[model samples]
Target: MPRAVAPRVRRAPAAAPARPAPPARSRRRLAPRFFRWAVTLTVWGLVAGFVALIFFAWDLPRPEDALAATRRPAITMVAANGALLSTSGDLYGETVRLRDLPPHVPAAFVAIEDRRFRDHMGLDVIGMIRAAVANVTAGRVVQGGSTLTQQLAKNLFLTPERSLRRKVQEALLALWLEARFTKDELLTIYLNRVYLGAGTFGIDAAARLYFGVPARRLTPGQAAVLAGLPKAPSRYNPRVNPSAAVDRAIEVLGAMVETGVLPAAAAMAEAERIHFPPAPSRDAGWFADWVRDGIGDHAPPTSDLLLRTTLDARLQAAVELRLEAMLASQGRAAGVSQGAVVAIEAASGAVRAMAGGRDYRRSPFNRATQARRQPGSAFKPFVFLAAIEAGVRPDDGVADGPINLGGWTPGNGNWRSRGEITVEDAFAHSVNTAAVRLMQRAGGARKVGAVAQRLGLPGPFPRDASIALGTAEVTLLDLVTAYAPFANGGRRVAPFGIAEMRAEGRPIAWLPPGPTPVITADAAEAMRRMMAATVARGTGRAAAVSGLAVAGKTGTTQDNRDAWFIGIAGGLVMGIWLGNDDATPMEGVAGGGLPARLFRDILETHRGRGA
Candidate 1:
């Protein structure tokens, strides 16, 4: 009883103080710790925002003139210097409206490449976040969640270099582009600029080159083939790798079905019937190369152009056929293995036919327009035309004897003199010594060079004694064009092939008529008559046409390294050359032999307008 009382008293005494029961202040202090944390976090956020502002303000690329050239849409017009080679790869890229695309094309692309395209505004936030997380987890960029708009933005204004700065720039440009253009407009620009396949730059070109059909005419199967090209055109080239391309196109067709772009049966049919015909592999590689060079000389290389050419399919085929036949017929006896043929309209600068070699696949020398080779007596026309202009006539007498040039002695091709002869006989016989004497009598080298220049020779024509021996190297194009004045009745119609050019249905440049008279009518007619005699009974006798009036000349360079037959018939000026690129001697070959025969065969075959 006593112990229980004592314990109760002691407990009551302790309870009396209660230790003041920890004050409310201590409990309240816990809130301050949380408040400090909140304040610290708030301060840090403000600091980060300020730094972001500074960076954004300082790191912007200034608006530049680099974009100035884009204000007016780039338009390119391509035309040939001679005949119509082709009118295929023409592009006047205006933004193609999404509505204009086969409808299913863009729909299929959206389904295959970007399903969330309709919901996004240039960027897919969820997709981006997911991709970023995945990249971080994988420690590499295994996924790219770029939307269609973003891809277009990068292609249009940014390079392929990868960096955080470029990524940021891409985002900025994408946002800006989205703000300025509608989905249709943006889609259209992308479609027009996107590379399709082959050497094509757009869906339109790819359609034509691969399918031999226009984009507007593309079927579902063909559309799928084109759609498959964006991933890797070269790797999945329908022309080079049809099986792979077909497999890839089937995937696109499947996407089309999934996206309701095509019915399932239609998609199946398209996938099953996915036929990709190989593109025509042109054997005229040299001709194509020459065409590129000619255009590049007058315009920049990157110029988006639709060139009109003067190439006649028929004439080109004829030239190629005749050349191959001639080379083959020569067997080993004709040691020459290279040749070129060029044909032009005498009244206009229209190039009708051009062949650079026997087979452009084997060689692309483009000897017709680019080769600088000795013309031999083929160049004598210019000298003779010049002499005629300087008061010498076809009937004018000149000594066909040994001629001496400044320490250089020139002899006839046969090393035999024809004594005194008419100017016509001198030209027809191609008497080198007499021609030298005539040049000396007709104001020497400078006058002959000037005459060649005036006649469109683009001469660096040699002004030495050997000039009469056709020592000056000249392009077949230049030589044929230089002879154009005589064929054109004394007017120099600068040789050209393109007829009319159009881009987006608008006329661009139409070739005007060429220069005025380079030689008097009398002189031209006299030279024409002389050259006609040459074809009729002289050196070019092998090139004579049965019914048509023809004028021509024959030439063979020193060591028989070159043989040339240049002439005009039925208003066409044609030049042909047979030679070796290595300057190897040709056996039993002369201008009047295989070259003249080939020329005559071509002329006879392709003489009429119907041809």
Candidate 2:
């Protein structure tokens, strides 16, 4: 009986219905878990899509009345309360309609850029996705997803920068353009708004630039050439690269033929008839360049502004005449090749006359505002001002003999010193030893440095023994700015060129008078008197004009590498410098000579001086 029970138990153990195979609940549990995960992921994706849609929809530029070329660039710099100074940047011709332009002109661009331009709405999503995929595969920007309308929108309202926000804006604008304008009208607007090479804008300007013909007169090959430029303006210029442009023209013609807008035979005929015009004149002066580049603070990149600067046309002409005459008379003999003059209204800090170089066409470097040369003794006015601030009289006594300071030796231009002299005498004669002793007595070189900074010496100013002898480098403009306080009885000056701004026949801005006081009236008057005495009977004597009392200082740098004269007239102050751009020494020329004469001429003739 025990054997039978054991056998039955052993067989029955496996037959417990295999526990019903756990009722197949493993897959059921997994199905619910997978469904929950799917639902959660779908919700998150929808939320993300909603957020993205809102982000792209908000803050779009208003498309109302934007159809006109209101955003066209026009920077015109007028003189201060006077005439036009200059005009720079892109210059556009009149806008043209598709009916006005030859059919091939727009046909060429459309065939090459977008074969289905007429079929798309504001956006061609399929084409854009295809282009995006192609660009991604290429790993560079080989293809552009932007339509012609998109490009027009970018030129009209956006900066030339690439980013996600900009791209979104570009897309929105493209949609606006597509919704508002017909295909032909859009092309017309694009023809007017695009920036072509060599500062030319619009299809009319481009046609004139590349073919010496109007937009309506462009031959098919010329049209193709201009069309190719939207991809790269300067690289495939027909005038610059004839063979390469012809090759690109061949491709454009093939596209035209494929799009059925042109027959291969006709396109080939145009390929042979293409002729490039001569390049237009790109001649510009330093002042024009400055106006173009320096109007950013007011106009900025988004606007096309008309700037009115504080330049006096009469003063500018006089300065040019005097500078040219002086250079022609004495340049070769004195071994001087270049010079600059900067004049500012004493009390107003308005830049009136600026001649940055002898020949701006040859070298566009602006010496008046950009070039930094050693001030030499021209820096002594600030030192003397510091002494005056420290309660030292203009007639105070100081040693003029040789002196040593911390292993550095400094000396005057002549290397010989008058034993003892009054501060006024030392300053007038430009005695280096006396100036150094006075700087030490006025509570060290740092005080002198402070005085220079206070008087508007935009620095890189050095505080050392050599500084007392005018060893620091400074721009002519800064020197003019520093000397303005003495002319205005202690008011600070920041030389400014912009006087007003306008845009599209409307007054947008006017510069207000700025008077920042940094010194006492007594100190400025005392310094002015001392400077007048120097011009009256000292090294700055050449700057003195008949029947006109002026205050001035002469500065001759080491080995005559830099010569400077800063003078203050009735209502204007000016600084003049003569030197080689390479800083090579002249044949013993001194600031008391040519520069002083230049100062005298400027002081006597400047219209703003009102003398």
Alpha-carbon TM-score of each model against the true structure? 0.74, 0.59
In candidate 1, what are the lDDT values of residues 1-611, reduced to their tens digit?
56555344433344444466668999899899999999999999999977875564355443243223252223332324332233334333344556566777676667656778767788899988988999999999866788877777666667777877677767777777788788777777767766666556666667666776656667888888877777778988887899888988888888888877889888888888777553332544555555555553343334444556666766667777778877877725678788889888887767777788777767766788878999988988878876777788888899988755567777676646757988888888788877887787778888888888888887687767677678788999888888888888788877654455444555556555666787788888898999998997789989988988888999998888899999998888999999888999898688988888889989767755357
Question: Which has the greatest TM-score?
Answer: 1
lDDT of 2 by residue, 64-171 (tens): 645453544756566666454454557565578888888988898888887667888857787789899999999987777778888888878677887897898888
Q: Cα-based RMSD of the predictions, in order?
A: 6.2, 15.6
What overall lDDT, based on C-alpha atoms, would model 2 receive against the true structure? 0.79
